[model samples]
Each structure stands twice: as C-alpha cells, then as structure tokens.
Target: MKAGYVIRDQERPHFITITVVDWIDIFTRKNYREIISNCFRFCIKNKGMILYGYVIMSNHIHLIVQSRDGKLSDLIRDFKKFTANQILAALHNEPESRREWILERFAKATETHTRNKNFQVWQYGNHAEEIFSLKFMWNKLNYIHLNPVRSGIVEKAIHYIDSSARNYADEKGVLDITLAENPVTDTRKNSEFWKYNSYED
Candidate 1:
C-alpha cells in the first residue's frame, strides 16, 4: 500500500484527525480510549512529540501536535501503526461483545489495501493541516474542544474529559498538553470563536 501523506514542515503544529475504518465507534470503551491516552503519554515522553491539544472521540481523534526532533511524519506514522496493533490485540484478547464483528470489519477494511497484512484499524491519511496563524490555531483548538459538544455528548466543551478543553479551561485532565505560546483568548466568552465550521474537508 502507498504510504500516508507527508507533512511539508515539521516545525509547525498541525491539526490532525485519525479515524477508525468505516467510522467504527471503537473508543466508546474505556479501555480502548485508555490505550490511546497511554500511547500519547508514551509518545510525548519517548518520541519527541509535543501535543499542544487533543480530543478522543468515539470514532476519531483530533490533535494539535508537532515534534521537537523534526520527525513529525515519523512520529505520526509509528503512532498509528502501534495503536492499530495494540487495539487489534485488545480486540482479540479482551472480552468484547462485538469481537467477531469488529474483527471482521477490520479485516474487510484491510482487504481493500495491500499495505495491511491482516487488519486495518485506522483509515489512512490523518487529514493533517498546518496551523499557520494564531487565528487558525485557535479555531482548530476550539474545534477540537467543541467536537463532543457538537456531537451532543456533552453540554459544555470543558465538561468533556477526553479533550484538552479542561486544561484550557483551567481544570486538570488526564493527559498533559503543552500550552500554546499565544494566550488563548477566552473561548467561552467569545461566541465567534466556535462559529466557524471546523469539520470542513
């Protein structure tokens, strides 16, 4: 299979989205989400990944990330590969009621691509876009936090524990994130911050 798209620059933080094949709600489970969170922590510690912001949704994840070692592409590629393998292992070894169906779906997804030997957990292409301006950065940042809210999963962005919104909201969260050098204008106070369509392709 062809390699995923490459980033033009490693110095700039990029907004990336990683989605499950067929839009599977794999992260609905606590353990599955934990796997992702644990991987992020590991990457930050060992892989020179600097996660500025992130959010884990039922079927996808959004991240504002960069690499200190100028290996953003390498870090993302490995992160996906590692998470897919670990999640696949969990599917087989863990007690999931939808085990058979999930495995079959992943296997089916892989059959369409030569790159995957057995199963394909994450769909190819992160849909990465470099954050070029402070306005754009804040836009993506707000979009990440507001994802759960837009999905009707939460009443407020700060209420979503799976996202870095809590950190921006001055609350402690599960994963640690590097704050942006530019002070984040109060998103809550500014309704215009979230008015833009964040999911545009």
Candidate 2:
C-alpha cells in the first residue's frame, strides 16, 4: 500500500505503534532484538527523531518519539526498510550462528507465507498516533512503558530489558536516551489540527 493513507508528519510529537503482520514474534531472538535496538540509535544519531519511550513486544512495538531534524514518518520508514532487509539477510546467510534455533523457528514460520523467501522478520507500517497534549503524551509514555507489564513480561517497568522504561526512570541503558517533556504541536490545542498531516507532499 502507498504511504498516502498512512503518511504522517515527521517533525512533530507523535505516539507511534507498529505491529507485525499476523502477530509474528520475529524479535523473540536476541539477535533480531538487537537489530531493533540499533534502529533506535540510527534515528537518534542521524538527528531525525527523539525516542521518548518504547517497548518491543513479541510481535509488535510501541513507541513515543518526536521528529526534531527530519520527518518522523520518513525516519520510521527508513528504519523499517533498513531493518527488514537486514533481518532478512541475517536469516539467510549468517543464520545467526549464535541463535541457529531461533533462525529455524523463523524458517518454520515462513513455511506458509508466500511473501517470505526464507522468513518474514518484520511486517511493514507503523500504527502511528500523534500525541497532541501533555496529558496525552504522558499517557502514551506510560502505555508504552507498561506494554511489557501488560504482557506479563515484567512486573516493573524498569525490569523490561528491551524497552526505554529504564531511561525514563533515570536508569542506565545501552543507548543514550534523552528523556524529557516533548513539545507537542506547533499550535497547542491546534496540535490535533496538524497531526498526521504531511507537511511534505
């Protein structure tokens, strides 16, 4: 599908969530999980977006970020595209020498899908929802941090390893995460007025 229907503004605060098609848990393997973490770094180092908080669910991901230098939509698109190809390649040539079993699991899942060659690591399209207010931003942040808790992965937010909950709570993580109140929209209450509106044609 074209981005026309799902397109969103990049340089704006947004509450974004993306899911794998059919809820496939492609990131259950640690190696694949690392790939996702790298995506976060790629965005930040490039000065595209600031990731406020996030959680990597079995098959889906929930995130809160804002585009500061570039479009958040383009950042997400690039991340997904780069990761999709990378994951697929790893599953093919390298096959995760460290996690061969996990590779096999992926191989088996793609057994029935026509789109996958050896496996389909990630499904495209992020389910993005722009956070338009302080209350809404806080709510979305809490929701993302609680994703693991809601899924029974951890009782406390800080314990979830593959999430940004720790960073928000002042705990150290593998990546440098800047946690602060993100400026919502350029126009306050009019925030919703421009959310998801692509400034770019």
Candidate 3:
C-alpha cells in the first residue's frame, strides 16, 4: 500500500486516480463500465462522497472528490472493495469472452501481494492531489475531461459519456456533480474562463 499522498482535510476536494491491477483493460466492456457508473451513484447517494468531476478510462478512472461525513478514506476503501467483488462476479456470471483469462490474471496478481485476498482487482494506492486553488482545480478538471480527447476516444470532451465533461457542458450526465462554490476566477456568463468553466468543448 502506498503511504504517500495522505488526505490532510477530508472535506477538501482532491484529484484522485484509481487504476486497475496490472493496468488491465477491465473497463473495455460496456457492462464493466456500467458497473463503475452504478457504483459511483451508490457512493454519492449513500457514502457521503461528493462527486465534483470524474472520467472513466479503459483501465483506470480520475475523480475530483470530497466527503461530507469526514469519511473520505473509508468511502474510497469500500468503493474499491465493493467494485472489485461486483466486477469479479460479473466476469464469472456474465457473458464475458475473456472471463477465464481475466480471472487468472486477477488471481495471479493476488498471489504476489500479501494485502490482497482471493483476487486483486484494483491497485493498492491511488494518486491523490488536493485541489487548493481555483486555477489548480480548473487545470485538473480540464485534464480529466480531456483525457478521452487526448487519447483519441472522442473529438470533444463533452462527447465522452463516462466523464463529467457532459455535466460541465450543461448536459444531463450519468452522475450529477456539484459545481465548486465561489470560484476564485469569475465563472459568470461573460467571464473569460466561461468557455472552460462550462466546457465549451
């Protein structure tokens, strides 16, 4: 487990990256992707987790998140644990073509790591950086939203259904995220940062 990047303030928003074990492309399937989306909604509604921005990539996910109940660490821990089990079940019970291969891979990953149980679906540590200022927040937000665009998955960031770019673009997205309050930079309709604020692309 990585000991670095501790959360000093549980209520403060942080940019987080959760990656799959061995960087596996587990989310290549639509079902697996939907599983993650459902988990996000569940966490938001019941775990006191605040979803600010997010993007689900093929093998990992980026999130701008905070907690209202002062249980950010616990929430994330449970989220990973639950998703791993749920996804493993899906691999076994669903019509996955690479079911056997994927299971073997997960099992192998567990054998080498003492922290894991039967299988290790997600990596142990998350790359977390606290969002302290408006500029930093915007920069990370743009990076998350533009991941798919940079990877050639979409021409526009808003077109990616698995990201918060749709929400920022003023469209009803998969998960509803709270816009940051009192952005240091003016996010008004006529402001210079309006294009990036509301995600023009």
Deviating ranges (above 4 Å) for candidate 2: 1-8, 95-121, 182-201
Query: The CA-based lDDT of model 2 is what?
Result: 0.69
Candidate 2 C-alpha lDDT tens digits along 1-201: 445425456566777667665676777888778888888898788756787778888888887777786577777777776887777777767655545665566567677767667755555556667666777876777677777776887767677888876775567866677675646534433432222122433
| Candidate 1 lDDT by residue in tens digits, 1-201 | 223345789887899999999999999999999999999999999999999899999999999999999888889999999999899999989999999999999999978669998899998888888888877887788889888888999877777889898776667988998977544455445443334322223
Whole-model lDDT per candidate? 0.85, 0.69, 0.83
Candidate 3 global TM-score: 0.89
Q: Compute the lDDT of residue 64 as modeled in candidate 1.
A: 95
The all-Cα superposition gives candidate 1 an RMSD in Å to the true structure of 4.9
- The candidate maximizing TM-score is 1
* Cα lDDT, model 2, residue 82: 81
Candidate 2 local lDDT, residue 173:
66
Per-residue lDDT tens digits for candidate 3, residues 1-201, read 445577767778889999998888988899999998999988888888899899999999999999889877787889899999899999989998888888888999988768877888998777888898977887788789888888998877777899988777678998888876536444354533344344444
- Between prediction 1 and prediction 3, the one with superior lDDT is 1
Which residue segments of model 1 deviate by more than 4 Å?
1-6, 182-188, 191-201
Which residue pairs clash within candidate 1? none
